[model samples]
Each structure stands twice: as C-alpha cells, then as structure tokens.
Target: MNLTVARLTVRGLLGRRRGILLLVVPALLLVISVIGRSSGSDKHDLAVTILGELSLGTLVPILGLIVGTGVIATEIDDGSIVYLLAKPLPRWKIITTKLAIAVVTTWAFAAVPTLLAGLILYGTQDGLAVGFALGTVVAGAAYSAVFLLLGVVTRHAVVAGLGYALVWESLVGNYVQGAKTLSVQQWGLSVAKAVAADGAIPAHVSLAAAVPLLVVVTVAATAFASVKLAGLTLASDE
Candidate 1:
C-alpha cells in the first residue's frame, strides 16, 4: 500500500469528532459487559446478547460504515479525492491503502472490544469468548469492504449502509428466512456457533455456505469499488 495514501486515510479517519464517535460504541460495550458480569444475569445470556446482538449486529456494521465511508466518501464529496486520483498511483493501491486503515480501525473499535466483552461475560468456557471474537474479526473485515464500496458508489453512503444493516439485515433477516442467508451478522453468528460447544448458540447458514459468502462478498466489493473509483477519476477528467 502507499504510505502517503495510508497516512492521509488515517488522518481523515481519526480526525475531528470522527475518532471520538468510533470510541463511543466500543467503550459502551465494555462498560455494559462489566456491569453485566457483576449482575445476576446468566453468562450464556449475557454473552449471546451483548457479543452476538450488540457487538456483531450493531457495533460492527456501524463502525464499518463510519470508517469505510469516512476514509474516502468525505474526500470524494469534498472533491479532495481528485488530487489523490490524479497522482501516478495504481488505483488498487489507493483502494487497498484506505481499505487497510478502515479494516484496522473497525477491528480496534469493534472486534477488540467484542473479545473483551465476550471474555467478561463468559470466559473461555465452551469457547464462547474466542468464538465471538473470531466472528467479529471476520465480520468486521467483510463489513469494511462492503461499506467501502457503498461509500464509492453512493453519495448517501452512511444512509445506505445503515439501511442495509438495520433494515435489511436486522429487521428483514429476522422474519425472512431467505434474508438471513445473505446477512453478514448471521454469517458471523454461524462462525461463532461453529467454534463454541455444540448448540451453544443458533446459526442459520451452514459453515460451508457462510464462509464462501463472506469471502466472495468482501473480495467482490473491493474489486468493484476499485473499478468505480477508476471510472470516477476518468469521468471527472473528461
């Protein structure tokens, strides 16, 4: 990746109130986990609720949206991306650079806290903590790629990202069986369930299906975003 592009992406992602916003969700998760750990709540319930629903469902997607879009969408919207695109750099490198920053940021703010929350809630019993943590890592990376493509493809990147996460994944997926197959949350959940002692939690999609879907989605999104960015640069110059 380009160091210059990587530096600029990091600066943009962590600058202003954006960095603070990224911290809020993870901090909130850790706090809640600590409290839940002390309370009368059952460990299994706490782990599934906080790590599964809160971490995987809510925190991962939103962080992916903010970091992914914030990395490039803001620059694109402000027309500052022109200078970067005009540079004699490989388009894929630029995309990869920004993508690397987004993945790391999302992992730090989402996955790390998730692992902590899982451990606080359930320890290593039945592989609960590690399982969910692994799920978060993979899911966070996938979310970053998907949302990064949305950032390049839409002016309403955040709105679009939220709609897909909340409306499509959370809402529709719960009631619609077919929708769950296409959900990042469910895919992650499937991964988590696979790691934990048998039947520790529910998983809708099979491991075979979920793993491939997750890989395909991330790679496709990145490939498409790179192409779109190249096209945008060419169109702007015309």
Candidate 2:
C-alpha cells in the first residue's frame, strides 16, 4: 500500500462536508438516547430494542453506505481514480486502503456512537454496551466492505445498498425466514446475542452462521473490489 496515496485518499474521503454528514446519524442516536434516558424508560429490554433494532438495524447500514461509497464513488464520479490507477501500486492495495478507511470510518461513525448510546440508555447492564458495541464494530466492517465493493462495481452503490439494507434485509428478512438467515442484520444480531447476557437478546441466526458470513462478506467484497478496481474503465466525454 502506498502510504502517500492512502493518506490522500483517506483525507479526501473524510474531510469537509462528508465529515459533517458522517456525524449526523450518531447525533441522532445520542438525541434519541437522551430522550429515552430522561423519560426514565431505561429498561434493559427497551434499551435492547432501541440499540439493537433502531441503531444497529437501521442507522449503521445507512452510515456505512454513505462512508464506504464516499471513499471510492466520489473519485469515480470525478474521474480522479484514473490517477490512482495509473500509478505502479497494485489495485488490491488501493482497494485495501479504501476498505480500511471505510471500515475505520464506519466504526467511528457507527460503533462508537452505539457504545455511547448504550451507556446513556442502559448504563452498562448485562454487557449490553460491550455486546452491542462489538456487534456494531463487526457489522460496520461488513457494511463498509460490501458498500465499498458496490462503489467499485456500480455507479448505483447508494441505491443498491439502500435496497439491500432496507428492502431486503428489513422487509424481506422479516417476512421470509430463509432470507433472515442470510441477512447482515440477523448476523450482527447473533453477535449481539453472544455478547449480551443470556436471554437478554434474540437473534434469528446463530453464532455458527453469523461469524462465517461476516468473514465471507468482508473478505469477498474486498477481494472483488480489488479485482474490479484493477480493470476499472472510465468513459471519456469526447
């Protein structure tokens, strides 16, 4: 990996407007946590519902979409990736660097907020903070890899990511049992189940299934993104 290239890419991906936008989701989580905390409805189950369902289920995926795609999509849009590709650096290194940025940004924007929100909402009961935090970390990394690959493979990354996260993961997974088994939401839920106290949380997929899927998605997406980046073509306006 070219440290100079990686540094430049990370800076461009994370600076200015993108940085502010990245903060919004977590700000919303904190606001919700504050309200929930003040309302004196800090039951462990309620905390689980809010953090597990609302934060992990919804917010994290969206943030991942924005950040992961932001890392590569903007370069693609502006045709700046050509400069990076023209260099002697291996395409895999570029993808890996971008994937690393995406994962770190996802963790910063999603997982950290989740930990703070868990602290505010439930005050560390049942390892809820640790469990949900761990789950968020894992899910964020997966989301970053998947969304980054989407950016490499298509111009429609945000739309495709939304469709997968909202339409397929939420809607279809809820209605179709088999789909639930394949869902990232469920996979993270499984991790959360393992981390939280026994019976504190429920996950449709078991740990056996979730761990492998997470690893597979992260690794496959990274590998595929590297391959795609190596041969990525830019259409000339001429």
Candidate 3:
C-alpha cells in the first residue's frame, strides 16, 4: 500500500458527504436496534431480523457501495485519476491502497455498529453479538472489494451496486433458495451461524461454501480491479 495514495483516498472518501452517510447509516441501525430491544418482541427473533436483514443485508451493502465507490469513483469520474496514474506507481498498488481504505472504512461504519447493535439487542447470550459482528466484518470486506471493482470498471458503480444489494441479495436471495448460494449476505450469515449457538442463527449457505466463495470473490475482484485500473484512460470532459 502506498502511503500517499492511501492518504489521498482516505481524504477523498471521508472528507465529504459520503462521510455523513457513513455516520448516519450506522447510527440508524443502532437506533432501531435499541427500539427493537425495548419493543417487547421476542429477543432472539428480533435480533435475527435486525442483524441479519437490516445490518448485514442493508447497512453493510449500502456503506460498501458508498465507501467502495467513493474512494476512487469520484477521482475517476472527475478525470483527476489521470494525475495519480501518471505517477511512477504501479497501478495495482493504487488499486490495493484504495481498496484497503474502503475495507477499513466499511468495517468502522458497518462492522462496529453491527457488533454494538447485536449486543444491544441480544447481549452475549448464545454468542450472538460476537457471531454477527464477525459476520459483518467479513461481509463488509467482501462488499468493499466487489464494489471497488465496480467503481473501477463502470461509471454507474452505485446503481449497479444498489441493484445487486437490493435486488439480488435482499430480494432474490431471500425468496429464492438457489440464489442464497451466490449471496454475500448469506455467506456472512453462515459465519454467524457457525459462531452463534446452533439454531440461534439460520444461514442457508454452509460455512464451507461461504468461506471459499468469500475468499474467491474478494481476491478476484481486487485482482480484476487492478487490471482495469492499469489500463484506465482519462474520462473525456465532453
């Protein structure tokens, strides 16, 4: 990771409106979790729904889309990426540095809040808090890599990412049994299921499948993004 590139990416990512979104989205999750805890609902069911559906399903992807795309997409869109690309740095280093920033930012916003939300809702009983927290961390990382690649490969990264998160992961992955196998949410949930007490969390994808897929997707996306970045030309002002 190039420190200079890392610094610029961090500033570009967190020093703008995207910063507000990162803060707000997680705060909303925590607020809802507190309300849900006090709602006199079944704690286990509430925890499951909030953490699984809201935190992992929604918050992680949203933050991922924002941070992942925000880190480099803005630079690319504005054609300022040419300045960085002209530097005597390997394209892969630049991509990796931006990706690292995205991953860590996503973790701070998504994973930490998820852990707090889990603790607020379910406490440490059945290891639910830790389990879901772990899930969020992994999922957040995977989402960062995937969406960062989208940013590199397409101008419409946010729209593409939203469709994947909302349509594919949230909608289809929920209703269609076969689709769960291809879902980042389900993969993360599998990790939670393994860590939480048996039957405490329900994950359609097995841990065995989830781990390999997560590794493959994250690595492949990062690698592909590097290749794409290496060949990237400045966007025309016309």
Give TM per candidate: 0.97, 0.94, 0.97
User: Model 1: how far is 214 from its true place, Å?
Assistant: 0.6
Score each candidate by Cα lDDT: 0.90, 0.86, 0.92
Off by over 4 Å in 2: 40-42, 233-238
Candidate achieving higher TM-score, 1 or 3 = 1
Q: What's every prediction's RMSD, in angstroms?
A: 1.0, 2.1, 1.9
lDDT of 2 by residue, 18-132 (tens): 8888888889999998888877564786788888888889888999899889989889978898887777787888888888888888898889999999999888788887788
Model 1 — which ten-residue stretch has the worst lDDT? 168-177
What residue pairs are clashing in model 2?
Answer: none
TM-score of 2: 0.94
Q: Give me the displacement of residue 213 in model 2, in angstroms.
A: 0.7
Q: 1-238 in candidate 1: lDDT tens per residue?
A: 8999999889888996998899999999999999999999788987888888899999999999999899999999999999999899988889888899999999889888988898888888888888888888889989999999999999999999999989987788766998999999989998988998897877889999999999999999999999999999889999
lDDT of 3 by residue, 1-238 (tens): 9999999998888885878888999999999999999998999999999999999999999999999999999898998998888798988889889989999999999899999999999999999988998999899999999999999999999999999999999999889999999999999999999999989999999899999999999999999999888768433322
lDDT for model 1, please: 0.90
- For model 3, the superposed segments whose C-alpha errors exceed 4 Å read 233-238
